[model samples]
Target chain A: MMLEFIQHLVNGLSLGSIYALIALGYTMVFGVLQLINFAHGDVYMLGAYIGMYTAHFFQLGQNSSVLALIFTITVSMITCAVVGFLIEKFAYRPLRKSPRINVLITAIGVSLFLEFSGQLLFGPDPKFFPQIFKPSGDWSIGELKINPLQILVFFISIILMSVLQTIIFKTRLGRAMRAVSFNHDLASLMGIPTHRIISYTFMLGSGLAGAAGVLVGLTYPKIDPLMGTMPGLKAFVAAVLGGIGNITGAVIGAMTLGLAEEFLVGYWAPTYRDALAFGILILILLFKPTGLFGVKQTEKV
Target chain B: MKLLFSSNSRHGIASLRNWILALVLIWMAHFFVADEIDPYFFSIIMYAGINIILAVSLNVVNGFSGQFSMGHAGFMSVGGYISAFATTQLETIYPEWFAHSFLMSLFFIFILVLAGLGAGFVGILVGLPSLRLKGDYLAIVTLGFGEIIRVFILNIDTIGGARGLPNIPALSSFGLLYSWVVITIFCIWRLVNSAQGRDFLAVREDEIAAEAMGVNTTQAKVRAFVVGAFFAGVAGALFAHYLRYLNPQTFDFNRSFEIIIMVVLGGMGSLTGSVLAAVFLTAIREALRSLQELTRIDFRMIIYSLMLILLMLTRPNGLLGTRELIDFIPNGSRKKKKSLESHP
Candidate 1:
């Protein structure tokens, strides 16, 4: 039982970190645009499929595994960043001045378009994600066992998150992003190119989501066109849980959600697992709409 | 009070007569119109009624109250299952109870109301919490509520789990479904014209300003949710009884988006638009069913998504926007007056 408990914890954190990565992307775009961007999930799905193809072509698992992993991640990230940028430019940019509901509908349209297009292109079958890194054996401490891949997943996620934090806080572009998110009109008045910042934000967010897509494949090793639907929704829940618009809060929320889900599956019926994330979402929205890390912004009359 | 009530008495009597005359006409169509149509065309008309009810109800919260809720499918499934279980179980145990056509129809109406209330009860649970939020947050929360409902329903073994409760008696005939559709559209239309309904629009237009003007935005929003969910439940009952099966999967987020698409395709705040779009979209989809299988390009949905994107890009105001159909009629200046009052 103790071993089982530890197993759940390690697995949960690994899963949570991936959610955090995806959630961070969600929160960043939301922070700047105030748009829900439902198609973000499909973007992540596209990332995984792209990663899968790159790994397959390069024979990532058969030769120079680490280099192969790096190449796969880079290719997927760049491709997804471009896709995200184009989505904003063509689909969302025109509707930026429109009502929130209108943009949301367009996002829904984009989401369906991507899913169906992916289905038509990818054939709706789940492919075994190429394991670029050979298992280096598990280490056992007393009754508990931990895999090296789990540790790598944890470290990689932390590195990416820290890098994102630096970009959002320490860089000039980050400053512009913060400025844009705060007030678009004022930011533009202050000579910040608001539209450019919005595009960059989408690219950055999509790139993070791509990294998450790869990491999730590394963990689960199964990729499908529809795989991102649940994770994307869960990551959105995580972002909200941590208080949307708060970067650190998103990580915390994702971890909390990941652990909660694992524990739910470990102790209760597995069927309740999916419902648990959404249940937490409702409770948080009602009780703490600002989220664990969010500062409530008052409505300006 | 006497002056206010008496000034419209003559017109009120004439309108009441017209309503009765229309009802009698519809009742006659039940015998003649319903029986004459082929099943394929009949299904299309029935589905149009269902979609209209769903769309119009959704408009109260989304179009009027300005909340971007996406949980109608969840509420719908709840009502569908409840009415399915209650009516089917009652039939299984006491087969003779709903034997007479007149008595059975009344019983089915009761069941639909019960289901609507069941759905509305869930709506309160969802609305009370989600109503506190605004904009996209509300949308996600509502969506989360929908997933929660679907997951919950999916786990319950007694209700057939993931398989779905099957073999429900097809008690929702054309007349029955049509009447409920008329009833739903009428009730919501009346609500849209009420003083409180105006408050719903105020909240939608500008929540902060509406609050400043002393409108209870929360009350108005929640009223939209309850009224909308109530009709969604009724629609659910009609849908389940008509299909004679209840699958939890039938009420997924896709279904919710489909209804939203219809509402937006019609015109957010226009009743006539919702009805027309429901009919139009359904007809188009039905006509394309064969081509969908033949071409295998998934062109129908691709075209749909493209329409949604281009519609927002070019005509985000939707087909009719905020204008009711009556406003287009030459003599219906009362609608013009109402529009001016609401907007002003």
Candidate 2:
């Protein structure tokens, strides 16, 4: 029983890391724009497709190398960054002065556009992601079987997160981003080039989503147009759980959600797995509207 | 508060005459639709009626009340499933004895009402807590409520799980279906034009101010939800009978979004606009069906979604911008009434 618990814990951490990656995109965009970029998940779906195509183009699926995997993920990140940039510029930027609901509706529209367009472009059938780097086998510790792929997913996620942290906290552009998120008009008054900053923020967040998509593809090896909807929704729940605009809170929420979901699937009925995140969301919203780490603001009359 | 059958005799008599005329016309049209109209065309008309009910009901909450609800489909599914279950059980008990009888039709209307009530109860549970939330948060919570409902439906084996509940009795006729649409529109129109409806409009325009003006904002919001959800349920019940099958997938977020598009495109808060938008979208969708078949790719949804984005970008106020179609006509009574009130 203990071994099984340990196994589930390890598995949950790996899954949590991917969710954390996606949830960060949600939190950051919410922080800056106060608009949930509903199409962010579709960007992740595009990222996986990009990675798959890159791997195929490079002929990296047969005898995989770490360098080949790195190249594929980097290409995906860049492509998704461009996609994210376009989505923000076209879909969201035009509605900056509109009512919140209008922007929200447009976001849903953009998300649908991506999903259906993806179905048209990539075909409706699910594609098996090219295994660019397959670990030899699993290593057992007592009754617990540890896969190297999980370790790889964990390490890569940590590296990406640390890089994100440095970018957000330790750089001039990062400070500009923080200022813009603090108050858009005020930041513009401060000559922060607010539009550019918002655009960059979207690109940065979407890049992370892209990386998450590739990591998920590496782990699960199946990709489809509609695959992003559920995970994207769960990631949004994670962001809300962690306090929508709080960065670290998003990561913490993602981990909690991932662990809970894994445990639910491991022990309880698997059918309830999808409902669990929403249940937590309802409870959290009811009990603590600001989230675990979110700072609250009084509404203006 | 006593809004039933307007107290003003002249106005009441005119509206009553209009209702009678409408009923006669619908009853007369029923025979033509049943016999002469092609089955395909008839089905499309039925679908248009269902969409009209869904759009108008949703407009009550999202448009008139200014609350963004993304779970109208959840209420719809609740109504659909409950009515479907009731009809199937009744069929089994009676074994086709009253399939086309007047007694069955009466019972069917009763079941539909019961379904609407069931959905309204769910609306209370969903709305009472979340309606207090601000716009964006309320939207998410409603969406979550919708997803939770779908997940629950998917899990329940007796309702046929993901495979869906089938074998519902088809009791929807042209008269029956269109009568509900007319009823929904009339009730909503009366409610909106009444003294109480001003409270709903007040709450929508500014809840804080509305409360200061002694409008029980919460009650108003909840009332809107109950009424809106009740009609959604009625529409769902009608839809289930029309389709004779209730698939959980049929009532998903996509369905909700479709209804929302109708409301948005029709100009929120305009009953006639909702009706026009519903019929227009359904017709356009049918027109696009052949293109999809020829191309062997589903571009209809792509075009629909793109149109949504463009519509939001260019004309968020929609076709009528909260004004009814009648208001556009010269010397319309509603317009004249507004002018008289202003002058007085």
Candidate 3:
């Protein structure tokens, strides 16, 4: 039982890392734009498709895992970044001055568009992602067995997250991002090119989502047009649970959510997984609306 | 307030004339177009009408009340399932005892309305917690409530669970559906124009100022939510009877989002806009289905996403914003500016 519990914990962490990556994208955009990018999930889905196609093109079935994984990641990230840029330039930029509700609807429209277009283009069948990485070894500590892929996901996620944190906190672009997030008007007044900053934010967020998609594809080895919907929703919930605009909060929230989901599925039933997530969201809202580590916003009349 | 629309009370006559003209046009369409419509198309129109009701009612809370509720479908599901269980089971258990069709249908409609009321009561319960929250926080709460409702429904065996309930008698038709539509429109229009409507507007505009001016912000929100939920319930009844199906998935977050999209695209507080947008969206969806066969491109949703993005970028206030068609008339000028200002 203890060994099974440890194995679940490892599995949960691996899943949580992907969720954290996706959640980070949501939190970053929300932090700066104050807009929920409803298309974020689709972007993630796009990432998986990109990675899968790229691997397939190279004929990297499951053998040349390292090279194929790297190639897929690079290709997916670039493609997703481009898509993200276009979405921002065309769909979101026009509605900047419009009511927030308008943007929200537009986001939904974009989401549907992605789903349907993907179905049309990709044929709606679940594409098998060519697993490049074969678990070379497994380590067992007591009853808990640590798979190589699980370790790979954890290490890659940590490295990427650490790098991302540094860029957001320690760099000039990060300061500009922070400046704009606090007050776009003020940031512009202070000579920050608000549009450029927002574009960068979108790029960064989409890139992260793309990377997450690659990881998720590797883990699940299945990609479908509609695959992004659940993960996207779960990531959104994670972002909110961690506080909408806080990056660290997103990571923590995703991990917690992942662990909770795993435990619930293990103890209760698989069907209740989503319900459990929503239940936790309600509980969090009831007690801490700002989310864990989120700053409470005061409305200016 | 009366003086705002009255030019020494003479202009009131002209405004009333315009209102009557608009009503006549709608009535004419109802009588002439509805009568000649094919049964299949008529059923679709009836469904559209129900959707219009749901979208418009949700707009009251979301658009006019300035609250983002992604849980309208939850209220709808509650109303639908409850009414279905009541009308179907009661009739099934004792068919001969209550054998009168007209009377039975009327009784069922009453029970459906009461079921809506119960859903409204649940809306109040949900809305209460949301009173303290704002924007995205409130959105999540409502979303959570919607999901919880779906999950609970899935677990409840009495309502047929995931398999869904069937064999519901159709209670809506061209005549009955239109009657309800007209009544709903009238009541909603009246409500939006009344003192309560102004309070709702005030709350939407600036809750702090409204509260400062003696408007009970909480009460106003609750009222809007309850009223919205009531209509959503009624729409659910229409759905239940028309489709003769009820499932937990039918009321999930996606359904909630669909209704929200209609409300948003329709111009928020504009009642006429919601109705028109609902029709437009339904028509577009149907058109897309046909187009898919010819184009071999399943990217219809992609086009929708592109359209949404473009719409937001180009016209964030939606297709109509808050302006009704009447507001564009030459002599229908009195309250036009005010309506626009209050809409988005």
Candidate No. with top DockQ: 1
**TM-scores, all models, native as reference:** 0.94, 0.96, 0.90
Which pairs clash in the backbone of model 1? Answer: none
Candidate with best TM-score: 2
What docking tier does model 1 reach? medium
In lDDT terms, how accurate is model 3? 0.81
Tell me what TM-score chain B of candidate 2 gets against the true chain B.
Answer: 0.93
RMSD of each: 2.9, 2.7, 3.8
Q: What does candidate 3's lDDT look like per residue over A36-149, in tens digits?
A: 888999999999988888887887775666767777788898899899999888888877877666677777788888887888878777888878776766887766679878
lDDT of 1 by residue, A50-163 (tens): 988888887786764666777888898899999999999999999887877788889989988888778778866688888887666788888678987887888888998999
Give the distance in Å from residue A9's predicted Cα in candidate 2 to where it truly belongs.
1.8
lDDT agreement with native, every candidate:
0.85, 0.88, 0.81
Model 2 spans > 4 angstroms off: B7-14, B96-100, B293-296, B336-344
How would you encode candidate 3's per-residue C-alpha lDDT over B22-61 as one tens digit per residue? 5666667766787788876776687788889888898889
Give the alpha carbon lDDT tens digit for every residue of B104-149 in model 2.
8888889999999999999999999988887778888888898889
User: Once superposed on the true structure, which residue ranges of model 1 sit more than 4 Å away at CA?
Assistant: A61-64, A136-143, B1-14, B291-299, B338-344
Residue A60 C-alpha lDDT in model 1: 87
| lDDT tens digits by residue: candidate 2, A1-301 | 8887888888898889889989999999999999988888899999999999999998999979888888988999999999999999998999898888888889888888999899899988899999999888898876678988888988898899889889999999899999998999899999999999999999999999999999999999999988888888889999999999888899899999999999999999888888899899889998998999999988788
Models ranked on TM-score: 2, 1, 3
